[model samples]
Target: MRTRPTTATAAAAALTATAALLLTGCGGSDSEDSGKDKIAGADTGASASASPSLSSSDDGIERPEVSLPEGDNLIFAPETTGDAKADAVLKDNAEYLRSIDEAIGKQNPKSEAVAFYSKDSAYLGSVEWISGFVKDGVTVTGTVRYFDRKVSFSKDGSAGLVYCADESKGYTKDVKTGKVNVTEASKDSYVLYNDRLRKNDKGVWQTTKSTSDRGSEVCQP
Candidate 1:
């Protein structure tokens, strides 16, 4: 099991879990954050114990206190099913990532992913959803990873939905170069305050203002 921090205050697990968000291919490999260069023959299969608290907890990282938001936000519950709309969104995101990998020339593609969302917040693998994941000028063509939907929140659902998305992703140019079997991962698990769903002026379900990001600047080209 790979665990990474939500931020600077959170650093229990290493960056391997989020690697899929940061990857491509066809395996149950987890994704990462930093220290990838040091990973050699790292086994990234599923962990025997699966707990969201443990999964999201990156022990030792500093957890700074922050103020909660006051506004209508979407939250997820335990039995949320997939709809034609949401599934399309998720599939599109997968395609978008393939383009990024092509740009970087990644090899040995593999990933496992999930998505979750609500009227207010959207989650990508237990992380807060944000717009603009990619850096400027990248012209990303698909959506990012979508996590599974959560039906219940222990608290007020201040955070968004939960996800176990495929954040693993990275690449190297030459196959002959000596390298460690390090995985790549990245994600910000938290909350996006005061998110709202907006409709286009024509009254269509335009994706510009969904609580979950359809696209934005979270990643770089």
Candidate 2:
């Protein structure tokens, strides 16, 4: 029953009704400009070395390994915050984002990485997002740069993270035709996200709730 952020605006129209509804928090409107930057090529296959390392919980619950396919890049700036807890939250958050892409690339609604990184509304929202891509027969490509990431802890021991995503160079690709639908960079190309995370007994920070605003003034360059 909770609402979460949607994906890029470039592909929102193509998504299913259920998916579109579930993904309202992270997308933008089409009235923006159209100037895109060149995207760099990425290596193919899922490699642990290529993705964020898994976080082990105190309960010894084995975390699922997350990986992305070719052309799907997630670049996070300031990989570390010098604070252990903050860094862990950032790393796990990156993993959660990566898991969504991984599920879409694999066309699997039941993704282990996704299940491992999220729970409750966040988890359900992610499944719907991946299902949308699968039903549309499309997958994501190109690079999504996440920067200006900041994390803070609440008195109740929950963590809140805010970050910006530059999705200008990313696009959706047709699975059957292998055609890439690229879009130009505009105000909508950048998104600002606010997420709530809680560390479980296993020592993993799972995203519980999230919200996003595309073309947010704070995220604009």
Clashing pairs in 2: 5-25, 5-26, 6-25, 6-26, 35-185, 57-202
Tens digit per residue, CA lDDT, model 1, 33-95: 112222232222111122122222133221112111121112222123475443333332332
Per-residue CA lDDT of model 2 for 95-156, tens digit only, reads 89998888888999777777777765567667887888889998988888888777766666
* Candidate 1 displacement at residue 11 in angstroms: 17
Name the candidate that leads on lDDT.
2
Q: Per-candidate TM vs. native? A: 0.24, 0.74
Instruction: Mark the 10 consecutive residues where model 2 has the least summed lDDT.
Output: 37-46
Question: Which whole-number lDDT from 0 to 100 does residue 218 have in model 2?
Answer: 66
